[model samples]
Target: MNGDLNERSTGRQRVLVIDDEPAIRETLDTFLSWEGYEVATAESGEAAVKQAKEEQFDLAITDLRMPGMAGDETVAALKRLHPNLPVIVVTGYASDEAAMRCSKEGAIRIVRKPVQLEDLLSLVKAALG
Candidate 1:
């Protein structure tokens, strides 16, 4: 499984939220937190993978274009670390190539930016299920 902290204390599904924007990260964190899920934020793909090394997460929400690793690469890496991990790619720009790459790399769904909490919550629920 996720190795360290695989069985979390809260019994809540731990979610890893990765984005370059602090506002988006904080917003998702707050919203998901309020919805009773344990959330972790990472500013880059590298950071997200590093955190994933130390902790297990039920789901991951990542931005498509980041300063360091791209979202598709992040999805590939995260999938390597945890094959069963469900990933959601959220981006302001979603081209056809982006969508294909995300799917090929193992993302379960792609949510465009200006993320709606309700839609995201529904996706998250379906993913964690």
Candidate 2:
């Protein structure tokens, strides 16, 4: 899958992909788009917040360690905007504290970096269900 998402069909589930890393953002955007999801990418937590407000996303996948706001902060802000929104946290720097906090605040799952697309697809399906 490439970064060109204009060819995708509509009416599928919309997913927001948030990551400061360009590689990760593009990877997820392409993967999700290939899986028949409508994908939107954001490079920062602040940008993600604004995008979330402007669009209706069925799910959000965010990175934990970002430049300014970070995943937790983004999740918190998103919760305030839409309490029932499902979020999945993907991070290289995983910790018990962060996982517990994310669970407490309402993330559907917290996946470590180097995740396999198959496993992630399963989680995404379950979360969306």
Candidate 3:
């Protein structure tokens, strides 16, 4: 009934993408799918949390800023629900303060936006491993 259910039936690793921008979410969903991952997308952190609670995801890639809950809150919620879940935060600009906070908040990686496919894939692989 749910999108994640379809992905699970395929026996693929599931990834949850949380971003406010439609283009970015679609692009990452397509790219991650091409890279052999089962992808689900949320337009805001609130939606992300809802989806995360409904389904199990191996990883979550979320934007630093969004309309409702920010990336930090999203990561916190995800960690609370799925303690072992790996989260990657993507921001438009590099911020030392944010990076430090996210690190302490349990983010596995903080990546800059306009992410290169290769670098993102490598990070994903490393985190998933």
Candidate 2 local distance difference test against the native: 0.87
lDDT of 1 at 2: 45
Candidate 3 C-alpha lDDT tens digits along 1-129: 465575478788999999999999999999999999999999998999999888899999999888879888888998999999999999996589878777787899999878998899999989888
Superposed by TM-score, candidate 3 places the C-alpha of residue 45 at a distance from the truth, in angstroms, of 0.6
> All candidates' lDDT scores?
0.94, 0.87, 0.89
- Model 1, 1-129: lDDT tens digits are 345546487889999999999999999999999999999999999999999888889999999999989999999999999999999999999999998999999999998878889999999999988
| Span of ten consecutive residues with least summed lDDT in model 3 | 1-10
Show model 1 residue runs off by greater than 4 Å: 1-7
- Model 2 spans with C-alpha error above 4 angstroms: 1-9
Identify the candidate with maximal lDDT.
1
Residue range with the least summed lDDT across 10 consecutive positions in model 2: 1-10
